[model samples]
Target chain A: MSFTMTKHGNVVVVDVDGQLIVGNRQELKQKVLDELEKGERKFLIDFARTGYIDSSGLGVLVSLSKKIREQAGELRLADLNDDLKTLFELTKLDTLFQIADNRDRGLESF
Target chain B: MAPVRERWPSAAGSTGDPAGPDAVRLALQLEVPTDVRLIGRIVQLVSRQARELEFPAAICSLNVPVALSEALSNAMLRGNKEDPAKRVRIRVMVDPAGLVMEITDEGRGFDLETCTQDPTTPANVVREDGRGLFLMRRLTDRVERYTEAHGLARNVVRLTIKRPPPADGS
Candidate 1:
């Protein structure tokens, strides 16, 4: 997956592309966790190009969310297509997450 | 081996067809590592098909289509050797009662009963890899396996799902 980190003030807007599968899970997980450690907890994930994310990828999201919340900050996801949106909803994560409809909305929340 | 001819049983019966076939054949294909794209495609297919066929509200609530994608990920990522040429056949069949999804790989099958246990619950939730089966079992009804007419031993999985009540119980 290809990711672009554009900083809107403290909010790290991550634009991701390609299939977010098992192959690149660790890298993505580490990158997000590392940023969270650096005190950049505000995140807006754009799934515009992300084709798929398996359980591992979902784990990273859950783990990262937990970590960020522990730090008193938050990770908000935006632009989740129908497929990914259904996944989070099916898993009952829509209730747990601060999901934004678009980038403007996600960034505006911060 | 037999060139893979999948035919829908005219109607559900104990003798000719399966225990029952609320399961309608949605699509069939050889699953490859690259076929991960099909994951979303399959989920989308099931949603549209189920709605058009008027299967049941449970079909949507149980969300077997989503679980099917995760199962494919396990078989393609861990089960098979990840050879592009080593294809895994995916069959998604849905019945009014529920949906049955099967992914037949060209590799050896592993033990299901062992992996079904949630090792990480109170003991080791921190561990990885063992989580896939946990998620699958949690999402689908009953995940089981047996060889199709192809006689492909120990390399196939049959996940049977009982339709769930509507999320809001409507």
Candidate 2:
């Protein structure tokens, strides 16, 4: 997976593209960790272009959410396709993090 | 001559009678080394067939490939320890009732019950692992694990989707 980081007001937006799986999840995790090190907490991960995700991807996102929350930072995901949305719901992860329909809404929420 | 080896019931055969007219049977078997890149190829095969079978939007779009990839990853990573010398076998069978994906690996198997920790818990949510099993169980209809006579560990995941009745009107 690849991430392009931008700022929408105070929320940091990380747009991810490509398949998010075990082989590439670590790059996304590291990006989040680097942002955390920079003391930028609020995060919005835009998944509009991501075609697929696997268990490793979910685990990475969960870990990122917890780490940000522990630091009093917020993380919200946006633009998940129907398939990904269902996956989040099926895994009960929808209850764990804030999910929005679009980047503007996700940015506005934080 | 050595006794002919029969396919195991635990394999990805039809839960219902496969010969029935209503059953649209499609099967594919793949044997690959413990390489993560090969998973993309398997996903492509599964996703293409699932789409052709006209499975429901969700089943065709995500669940099948995701669950199958997880099973394959486990077979490659945990079951085979990413050993290039080892091989992982993946069998996918689709029938009218549902789809069955069986993955076998050449390695010493662990106790599935003991190894899988619930990732949904508050304390364990941030562990960044062990969620593969959770996702497989949640996404598929039924999952079975066994140690075959070949000293291989086989993980079978079955997903039930509603398919149209046979075109001939059986």
Candidate 3:
């Protein structure tokens, strides 16, 4: 997986591409946490290039969300395609985080 | 010499029969672009075929297939090891009285229980990994991992979704 980080004031937009699975979970989680530690509470993970996600991917998201929320912040997922959207719904995670259809709409919320 | 069979149930009312001796018809490989719709399509196929052999929705086989698909994704594409073109072999069959769903991969086999994915805990839900196996256990009646007799270390996973008793009052 490839990760690209871009900062928008307090919002850190992390763009993930390719398959997000077990092998890359540690590096991905650490990157998110490192940013979270710097008080960048709001996160917008754009899945524009992400093809697939598995258990490890989902777990890291959940853990990171908690980490951010604990610091009085929020985490949002943007541009998740229908496939990933169904996964979120099936797992009932669509109810927990703030999911938006596009990046502009997602970042604009905060 | 009879082929090894593994069986289990699902959580949804997925009516799939795994008896009567009919074998599963699964494509021998992973055809890229693993999306939710494709996953649902495969789940539907498994659910339909399993129900045909009498393993009806008494165990929610629908969710079980999802879990299997998750495992497939992990074993197939997660290692930057997408070279040589891997194929995920899925077979569904019954032995004596057990319903089995088997997925054989062309990659190196790994441990299942040691995985650290937690879908129930929302805090860890968005990490991009770890939820597949987590959900697999939650939605299926039972899940087990073992090495195939051929020494291929194939991940022999199964879901024994039971069916409701006949309504004839017999």
Deviation of model 3 at B63, angstroms: 10
Tens-place lDDT digits, model 1, residues B35-87: 55455555556656666766565345334554666777776776666666667
For model 3, residues B1-170, the per-residue Cα lDDT tens digits are 99775433332223554444464332222243323224445545665655565564533243444565665555456521454355555665433243456655555566777775555565654444446666667655566666666855555555443334567954
Ranking by lDDT: 2, 1, 3
Candidate numbers sorted by TM-score from highest down: 2, 1, 3
- Residue B30 of model 1: what lDDT? 40
Q: What DockQ class does candidate 2 belong to?
A: medium
lDDT of model 3 at position B109: 61
- Best by TM-score, which number? 2
lDDT of 3 by residue, A7-84 (tens): 987789999876555556667789988888776788999987875565656777877888888899888999987667
Highest-DockQ candidate = 2
Cα lDDT of model 1 by residue, A29-49, tens digit: 777887887878788888877
lDDT of 2: 0.78
Instruction: Kindly provide the TM-score obtained by chain B of candidate 3 when compared with the true chain B.
Output: 0.59
True contacts kept of each: 0.11, 0.51, 0.38
Weakest 10 consecutive residues, lDDT, candidate 1 chain B? B9-18
